[model samples]
Target: MKLQGVHHVAYRCRDAKETVEFYQKHLDMDFQLAIAENEVPSTGEPDPYMHIFLDAGNGNVLAFFELPSQPQMGRDTNTPEWVQHIAFKLGSMEELLAAKERLVDAGIEVLGPTNHTIFKSIYFFDPNGHRIELAANTDEPGMLQELKRVGPEMLEEWSRTKKAPKTAAWIHGEGEFPGYQG
Candidate 1:
């Protein structure tokens, strides 16, 4: 079956109001709607929560839920902090730089306009401790095609060894592989 597109991606938040305000002030996301219920619609269990949705440009939606009855929100102990992050694509490099400056000026510790060959990104954390990345594409011609060409081999090696395959090292700004420029 063919997939249409992502409806939304949801995550747990410490406070729904804080999350809404943060996204609105920092990322300029529009607070679309909020949902509150005493029971989960799908689970039929009695649990109170406040769910909120924010516009992430181009019809994309980012969502969060605050479950007051549950314990404090925390990330998976087994997962590395940097392993799971929400990445948003900015319109251009100018926009990306501007956003980085804005975040830094707001007293947020921003990481980088780190070059990834195909894109440049800056990373920061939200009030909820969620790592967020804003990226701008700067891929050269045929870069994605070259990466696509190695996809099969990369997956095969990764499946067998459960290790990162070097096939796409070019994308990470290792030795230049001709397709993408850093």
Candidate 2:
């Protein structure tokens, strides 16, 4: 079956109200809907939760679950915090930088407008300690095509060696692409 776009992505939150307020104030997300249930419909377990949905623009929805019955929440220690995050796309570099400034002004510590050749992004954490990223795409005219062309080879080599492949170093202008002069 072919899948359409995501209906929503759900995560645990400490407080439904606080989470909603945080997204609404900081990210300008609209509080779309909320569902409170005494028992999980799928499992029929005796648990109460507040499931909240927020509009994340362009028909995307971000959701959170506040489980009063569950123990205090924490993140996976085994995984690097930076490795697991929800990234959002900003319209442009100016917009991304403006967001970083606004967040900083609000006393939220943020990191980066880190460059990745094709994009630049900033990172921050939500009230739930979930890392969030706002990125603006900055791909040059033919950069994406070149990257896509070598993607398979890069992946195969990386799989075999478990090391970064040099096939796409030109993405960062480390060297020229073979047979093509800039």
Candidate 3:
């Protein structure tokens, strides 16, 4: 079952209007469309929702649903705040920096342009308390291919030890092993 690409990814939002406005103003995503339903189509239960979609560039669509009848929306308490987030890719380092500044100027606290050697990224939260990341790639020649080659080994090592594997440490400026350097 080969797939072309992601159609859309959906998340629960506190307010549909606020979410649409935030994405439109801050991230420059187009507010594509909205949907309202009084009953669940699949479940046949009466659960009203306001669904909205935003274009997240490169044919990717980000979506949200505001369910007013349900309890307040929240994230998983057990998971670390940074563990679950929606990451968006920016065109270049310049665009990433500009986005960071724009978020800060809008009174949102942002965290890094943290350099990971292969890429740099900044993080911030939206009005709904959803963490978001904007990243720009800066990979060196053969970097991605090398990482891909080591992916299986890294996953195996991780599964066995539940520890970070050293195979891709160079991407974080960590000490490198031979045959894995620029």
Candidate 4:
């Protein structure tokens, strides 16, 4: 079956009200709606929950569940904190920088303006300890096109070697390969 698009992305929050307020204040997400239930609709489990939805713009939605009956919220211990995060795109480099400044002024510790060759981003955590990234596109003309052209080859080489392929090393300002035009 063909999928339309993501309906919503849900994560666990410490508190529903706090989560709503945090997104509203920091990300400017509007509280769209909330769903409270005494039982799981799909599983029929006897659990109470508060599900909240926020407008993440462009027809996308960000949702959270306050599961009071569940155990204390914790992240995966085996995975690095930086590995799992929610990333939102900003319009430009200026917007990314401005967001970083605003988060810093609000007493939130932000990590970067980290350069990913094609984009720049900043990282910070929400009240629920969920890592959040705000990134802006910065790719030069033909940069993305060049990467797309080499993507399949890179993936195949990586699958066989389990090492990063050098096809895209030029993205890091490395010298271009023999046949690469970008």
Leading candidate by TM-score: 3
Pairs that collide, model 1: none
Model 3 TM-score on a 0 to 1 scale? 0.95
TM-score of each: 0.94, 0.94, 0.95, 0.94
lDDT tens readout by residue for model 3, 1-182: 99999999999999999999999999999999998999988998999999999999999999999999999988899999999999999999999999988899999899999887778999999888899999999987778888888998999999999999987887767865335433
Candidate 4, residues 1-182, lDDT tens digits: the string is: 99999999999999999999999999999999999999999999999999999999899999999999999999999999999999999999999999999889999999999988889999999999999999999987778888888899999999999998988887766875334364
lDDT tens per residue, model 2, 54-149 = 999999999999999999999999999999899999999999999999999999999998988789999999999999999999987777777777
Q: Judge candidate 1 against the unseen true structure and give its global Cα lDDT, from 0 to 1.
A: 0.92
Tell how far residue 66 is off in model 1, in angstroms: 0.5
- Give the Cα RMSD of candidate 4: 1.8
Model 1 weakest lDDT span, ten residues long: 173-182
Question: Which of candidates 1 and 4 is the stronger one according to TM-score?
Answer: 4
